[model samples]
Target: MIRHRDIWRALDTLAERSGLSTSGLARKAGLDATAFNRSKRLTGDGTPRWPSTESLAKVLNATGVSMAEFVALMGEGNAQALGQRIPVIGYAQAGESGYFDDAGMPVGTGWDEVLFPAIGDPNAYALEITGDSMAPAYRDGTVIVVAPNQDIRRHDRVVAKTVEGEVMAKELNRRSARRVELVSINRDHDDRVLAPEELAWMARIVWASQ
Candidate 1:
């Protein structure tokens, strides 16, 4: 059953994913800035106060999130509707053994889990940036969600693994059956061109937590 806590948490999640604070979300919804504030979640007597239906609708519309998504966010537990629990590893550790298979799918062990928005790809994983090489575009500590099932398009940001166990995130300058060209966001880093034999696998970076 839906509860006050779940509803409030759902709002917080919605604001977070929308890149807004609760007040910011409220303001954007044309409501008072404190509408979804924690202090307003309870009355002066500390009793629960639910958000009005009108306010909820406004927030959903303001964020371009449907009612279904908002209700899913209020799920009781780790329901499929909540999101996917995908493997997460640091970019620095992606080159290590036992973390992935030749197909770029995560395998073996030593992987942590992070809840990511469902994008219909069970093989999706998250890579936490650990260096400045991918900065400005992907700063250190940012988490990038990789979708192996997604088609890699030219000029798309991608994460690739080399046959030599090297893993790097770069923009796909060009792609062909035999060779692919990569351009790094950092100017100090040299771009690369590799043949099929040199690249183990490459996947498009669908989303990132900056």
Candidate 2:
């Protein structure tokens, strides 16, 4: 059965396969740049606005995708495929309340989501970089996949959240029973030595959407 979310995910997947954003895809197809935007997916009265066949055909032709290829893309992100999706949020919002549980698992609502090829932990979530602080290694808007249940090791990129509500991304230098030593992702930022007792949770950064 075709569901509302399936069509949206298929559109997003199509855009990804073509190396374009949804707006870019629409523009490339000679449609309004917002044609496939999430905001345009529903009417003002809240009815779903299914993509018109004409628009679909235009996009398919523009991307050189056959009907069969489009159908295949539609099937690629069904419920079974969401096993690889992780709830994502901006780094600025990572420290906000109700977004994470005590163990740092994603818990609350309003999470922007993404489909990744692979994630080591089922409970893993993603963080979108929002500033220049993590430059050189990670640029603004970069999406990083983090696994809260994974073991932290030396040289592994990590996401650490503190009890005072600070969340940071850095490289693991060393971890002992008491404290964790970390190197800054940007050299301009100083290194850190965090006491484990002061941390809410710390986890390994497993993948990135570069």
Candidate 3:
């Protein structure tokens, strides 16, 4: 199956490795900032949004990752090639009350459905941005992939969930004895420091569209 979720996850990984958010990735690729945003993922009636070939090529070029590498990141390897199948849903509906469980796993309910060729791994999922706080780097409606199994390194862009129930995307700076520092990709955004106790979970960004 050509799962779209897998492609999204791969993009998230690439962003993290390059220290960029979805919007940052789009900027690096010379595309519109919202090219990868969640809002653009669907039409008002709900549809599977697709990226232009030119944009995809640009993203691949900016990341310096080959198509094979991207496919591998999505866990399909070269044994299978991407088809037209993709999973579709509204960005606003992705994080609805029942869409995710207490552990943040996809619960597969309350979603406005649409369909595309399956091109990604079933285990992979997408997250929709709900606010403009990450603007210039990520606009409202940008969909981000969280690859929990991917290795996280210093300077990587990450989606961090705090114990207080806050989810934020920022660049991982340094970890000291008791605190973690994160740098925002947007110049207007300030860096943040959090105590270890405030951290509940952190995942590396694998891929983003815009």
Candidate closest to the true structure, highest TM-score: 1
In candidate 1, what are the lDDT values of residues 74-136, reduced to their tens digit? Answer: 765534555677888778778887778878888865578766546678999889898788878
Q: State model 2's lDDT.
A: 0.80
TM-score of each: 0.66, 0.62, 0.51
Per-candidate local distance difference test: 0.82, 0.80, 0.66
RMSD values, in order shown: 10.5, 13.1, 13.6
State model 1's lDDT.
0.82
Which candidate, 1 or 3, would have the higher lDDT against the true structure?
1
Candidate number achieving the greatest lDDT relative to the actual structure: 1
Give per-residue CA lDDT, model 2, range 26-106, as digits (tens). Answer: 999999999999999999999988987568767876887754456556675444443466788878788988788899898
Candidate 3 residue-wise lDDT, 70-105, digit = tens: 666775553244532223334555434554455544
Against the correct fold, how does model 2 do in TM-score? 0.62
